[model samples]
Structures are given as C-alpha cells and as structure tokens.
Target chain A: MITKHLSEVTTKFNPFSKQAKTCRIFLATLPANARQTMKINSKVLPRDTDAKSELKIKFKDGREMQFDPDKHSIKDVAEEVDRHSRVLNRQAELAGS
Target chain B: MSPRLGICRDCLRKIRSPSSSTKRYLAAAAAATATTPAAPPSFEAQPPPIARFPRTQPPSHKPPEFRKSQLHRQYTSLLRSTPLLLLFQHSNLKSQEWVSIRRELSIALSKVDETYPQTPPLADSTKLQIIQAGIFESALRIAEYYKPPPPPSPGDSLATPSSSPESTNATPDPSNPIFTHALSRHAHDAVYKFKNAHPLTPLLSGPLAVLTFPTVSPPHLKAALSILAPDKQAGFPAPTRRASPGYYDGAVQAGVAKMMLLGARVEGRVLDQGGVQWVGGLEGMEGLRAQLVALLGAAGANLVGILEGAGRSVWLTMEGRRGLLEEEEKKE
Candidate 1:
C-alpha cells in the first residue's frame, strides 16, 4: 500500500482542514492510478487513459461497497464521494481520540 | 204698615176707580227689583279657577327595594361568615408576590377550565370570562407595579457587604477565599439541581451539552459538568482546549439564536471559577440551546461563527483552537 501524506489530499479539497481525516480515507479508496493523479494543487490533474473507468471498493472496516459507472450506473463522482464519506467520518472519529 | 194704612186711607178718600192700596203694593215691588240687578254682573263675568292643593311627592331611594336590601344583607353576611375573601385577600403583597399569585391564578383558572370542559350557559360563561379576564389583568397590573430590585453590581456589593448577608455571601472576596469557596460549592449544587431537574434530556444527550459547556469559562464548565454523573461525563471526550470565556459566549449566542429560530427562549447561567456566574431567569433555555447546537452541527458550519453572530460572547479560545489544531497538523 502506497501511503501518502493525508494533508496532501486534504489540502487539495479541504482548505479548512476540518475534514482532513475523512478526505484521507476517500483518497485511499480510489484506484492507485486514479489516486496518483489526485494532487493538492488548485489545477485539475490530467485524466488517465489506462485506468479502469470504475472499480468496486472494499473499505478497511469490512463494509460492503461498490462503485461502477456502467453496471452500477453511478453517474456523479461527487455523489460517490459522498456515499463513501461515512468511512472517512468513522476514521476521523477514531483518529480524533 | 203705616204707609200702607196711609195709602189705604188715601185710597178710601179717592175711592173713585182703583184703590190706593193697590198702587202702593206695585211701587214697593218695583223698588225691590231695582235694588237687586238682573243676575249680578260679577257672577256672569268670570268662571271658577281650578283648585290645586300643594303638590307633594314621596322621596325615591334608588339603590334597592326593601326586600332586595334585605337579601343583599343576608348574602353579604353569608359571604362574610366564610373565610373566602380573607383567604384570597393578599392585600399586602410585596413586589415579587404577584409573580407567585399570577402563576397560581393561571394554574387555578386552567384547572377550572380543564375540569369543567362543558361550560355553563352563555351568561355564566361570559361572567366567568369576565372574572378571569379581570383576574389576569389585575394580576398583570400587580406584577407590573412590583418591579424586582435591580441586580446589585459588583462594586455595589463590594461597598455594602456588611449590610446584606446574602449579597455578602454571594459576592466573591479575594481576601476571604473561604467565602469564594463556599459560593463555588453552592453554585455546583445549583447546577446539579438544575441539570437533574432539566426537562430536555433527549435533546441534551449529545451536541447540546458539548456546545453549552465550551461557551462558558473553564471553572463554570467544570462546575456544570460536575453536576452530570461521572459515567456520563466519561462517555464524551474531554474538550481538547481549556475553557475560554469567549468561546463559551460565542457558543451560547449561537445556541440562543438557533433557539429563537425554533421559537424558544434561551436560559442558562454563565458561571465562573469563582462560582455562580450570571443566572438568567428565562425558562426552557436549556432545550432551546440544545436545539440550536443540533441544528448547527447538522448544517456543518463553523459553530463559532454562528455563535458570534448571535450576539453571545464567543471567547478567543475558539479562534485559538482552530489555529492550534491547524498548526499541530501542519507540523505533523
């Protein structure tokens, strides 16, 4: 597992740093190719051609989860991000203590 | 008779045609008729005037007829016999007395209405309504008349500690640490009682308590928290930051605004380490503050901003917390 600084992903999306823990979990759930392209800079990263368009994810907590554009018909990636937000929340709660 | 006899003698001397006696009688008749005019002119000139005796009338007594007066006296005596008026007189109430009286009256009237769901006829209903209205109005007037004395200021207490034991006991004295210590203990007792008797446990279960405590000073927060049993306190994580007055103020202000939005009044005491802080007389304030915290937490805003905007004292600790948290994370 490639471990990256959680701040790198959080700073990119959550400038407030209030949701740093949640952002980390969401980034970790992404495919390696997709996750590598996700940078903290304001500019959007280039899309990868070889990366699978969609993938199912098994969260660290053993929760059943899946994300697919065609078969599952998940249209909005932002919505998908929200769908997995609970994972990040649980993680944050644990880390907060 | 002599005249008549003379006439008769003359008549006899001149007895040639009519006798003298007849002429004398006719002359006498004419003289009598002349003496009394045809029907006295005064009698024909005016008709009789109407006779009017002095117009006397009896005096009128407006209040009551004798029968009614007797009945009223009887009723008054009956009313006097019972201690009804005496029981409810309350004539010599001081300023705060009406607060209790009004509350009692409201409770009594409410009970009456509740017990007698089927009211009497319109007349009786109207009478009761009027009486109730009068009672309410009078109670309100009495309450208005009796204004509570203004809160004694810190300086005022400092000046007159000798005069008032209660005030002296409440006023914190740097020189008398024991007094301050006792006050703090009393405040803790009050807080415990308040929390135990609090009516909004369901709403207060989580975010409410969290937001309320952080807004007050540390000592007050500790005292307030002490009221909650140890087990409950252990359930929630200890706040990362020391209690700061500004943060607590901000939280309270935010909480109040949220409550106001929900159509509730915010109530709670702001206490310091010295003990009982500011005691507000508002009711249902805890519930209101709890509701506000829940709403803000659900909405996901910086709870501090909303609190400050609501005109509560948000201590500098809130700002410091955010900054410190950010700095600590950056170092990592």
Candidate 2:
C-alpha cells in the first residue's frame, strides 16, 4: 500500500522535458482520431517520456494549448491520463471492499 | 325796452331748462342707486378646516381557557402524587402490574395538558422534578419486582418477628436516596437490579458487576475466586491475575512487570512515599505497602528489589536509632 502511494507521488513529480512538451503540443493539436491513436500507444513509449503528457495528446482531439513550466501547471497532454489514473485508483479502492 | 324784453325771454327759457335738467339728473341718480348696492365689508377670514383622523380601539386581553388552567392543576397534582404512587407499586406489584401502573401514571400526567384551562407554563424546576420523579418511580417499581427474595433461614436460626413500621419507613428513605442523587444513584440501582434479576449467573458473575458499576474497581482475584467458587480448594494456589491461564505467558508478563515498575518509580516521586511512612498508622502503612508492592510487581524483580532494599535499609536505620534511645533511657 505504502509503495503504491509512494509511486503515485513519484508519478505526480515526473519531470517535464522537450519531448513531453512536444507530445503535449501534438496531443493538443491532433484531431480526435489522431489523439486516440496517441493515447493507445502511450504504454509502449520510453519510461523517461512523460506518460501523462503522452496520454493526454492521445486522448484529447487536436486542440491548441499553452502551459508554463515555471507555473507548475498540469500539461494539456497529460490531463486525460491523470484523470483516468484518479478514476482507476478510486475504482480500485472501492473494489478492495 | 326791446333788449329788456329779449333778456326776459332768455331768462324764462333758462328757468324751464333748469327744472327739466334737474328732473333728468334725479332720474339718473335713482337709476345708478338701483343698479349698485353699497359694497359689503369683508369680515375676518374663516380658518381652513382641520384634517380629521379615524379613531382606533385599544387591543383587548383574553384570559387563559378553563381547560388550560385545569391541565396546569393536574400537572402540579401529578408532581406531588407520583412518588406516592411509585411506593405503592413497589411494595406488592409484579412486572406486569408495575407496567400497568406506569402506563396509567403517564396517561394521567398527559391529561394535564389535554384540556384548555389547565395550561400553566411548565416551569423548568417543575419539569425537571416531573422527569426525575418519573424515572425514579419506574426504576423503583422495576427494582422491587425483580429483587431476589431474602436468603433462606439457616438451620437452628431463630427467626425474628418482622416489624412493619420500621421496614415501611426505611424502604421509602432508601428509595428516596436513589432518586435524590439522580444519575449516580440511578447507575447504582441499575447495577443492583441487574445483579438480582439476571438469570445467567456464571457468565455474569464477575464481568456483569464490573460493567454495571463501572465506577467500582473489579474485586481482587482472590476475593473474586472465593466469591465465585462452587467449593473451597486445597492449598493457597498462586492467584492468577487474569481468569484465563497462560494468557500472559513469560514474555508478556515480563514486559508488563517492567512497565509496571517503571510507572511506579515515576509516580512514587510525585506521590511522596516518605509521607506515607511518616503517618505510621497501620492503615496508612498497609495501604502504602500494598501500593508499593503492586507497583514493584508490575515493574518486575529488578525494580521491586531496588525498592525493597531501600525500604529494608530505612527500617534497619530506624530500628537502630530506637534501640539506642531505649539503651540510653535504661542507663539513666
């Protein structure tokens, strides 16, 4: 349980990089069909690549977006994955009953 | 002479003209007088009419209804009568009888507010008294019905004749104390009732009493075992701390004993064990000694030995000083 919790904290802090940023931009700009394709491919990507950012682009249809790294804001690309992760975690907790 | 005659003619014409002109002038004056009356003098101006307002009647006060007054009276009467009713119910009633009595009492009390004339504001003290009376009455009735019969007369025992006056008076006073103290007394009565009435003695014997009178510490193991025993056992067996044997085992006991000793030494400093010694009375000494022993037992041998050694040293020193005093007195 503790390890799972720690991993979740680590996932939240996963660093933003140029590739993650580029993926975030691509996800924001991709059409819905293209975004879904990216999301489906997120699991096969490099561990260093921001999975959340990659997932966001995969899920949301191409929509232009901007976020400041200095602002510590959630990237548009990773938002969908973050949302899904929250939902899955909650579901898991409920299932444990 | 001709000039004089012309003058006379002119004078005659002038005279005729003067009368006619005078008549015309009088007629004109009459007509003017008829046309206009003398201007009426303006009297002092009348004051503007003052604005009038409609009159309003004062609000009327209505007396409380007869039924309200009657209910208030009944409430007061119930307060006085409830304790008496409870005493009656307690003496000779069964559980069913007591329940009926309680229901009747509730109905009677409720009727106080049912009618219009009897509505006196329920004063706080009166309300509290009523509630207290109700609880007391209910508990007393239950207790009386459920209480066990007195212990059976022993063989060869002389039966004393029962006195009615003393018992009757005594009963009321004893029950009154339970009501007077309210919560604490109620808790005491509840425990008493449970102990007397509960059918399962074995299951309840030790734990029920403790649970009922939570303020009371559980009886010592030796005392409890004796009270609960079916028969006396041979030899003074090591009294078990817990009911279940081997519950604590070696490790748990050792851990508990160590903790106990530590707690004692820490508490002892604040408690001032020396003061207990200074009192020197048997009770004071015994109490202090028991407490010290219990603490040592909890703390284990190491802590207990330290305290015991200190106690022995103090005792020897006191004894020596007493002996020296006695020897000096003998020589003198």
Chain B TM, every candidate:
0.14, 0.13
Candidate 2 DockQ score?
Answer: 0.02
Which 10-residue window in model 1 chain B sums to the lowest lDDT? B257-266
> What lDDT, from 0 to 1, does candidate 2 have?
0.31
Which docking category, incorrect, acceptable, medium or high, applies to candidate 2?
incorrect
lDDT of 1 by residue, B39-106 (tens): 97767875543322212211112123455433433332332232111001111222233333233223
Residues B1-332 of candidate 2 have per-residue lDDT tens digits of 53666668667777667777798999999999999976555655655433231122111111124443333334333433332110000111233433333333233233322432324321111121112223333333333333322333543123432212222322323223222221223334544544424211211111011101111111221221121211123221322545434323443222211110000011112111122122212222335568999887778977778889999999999999999999999999
Worst 10 residues of 2 chain A by lDDT: A1-10
Q: Looking at model 2 chain B, which ten-residue stretch has the lowest summed lDDT?
A: B259-268
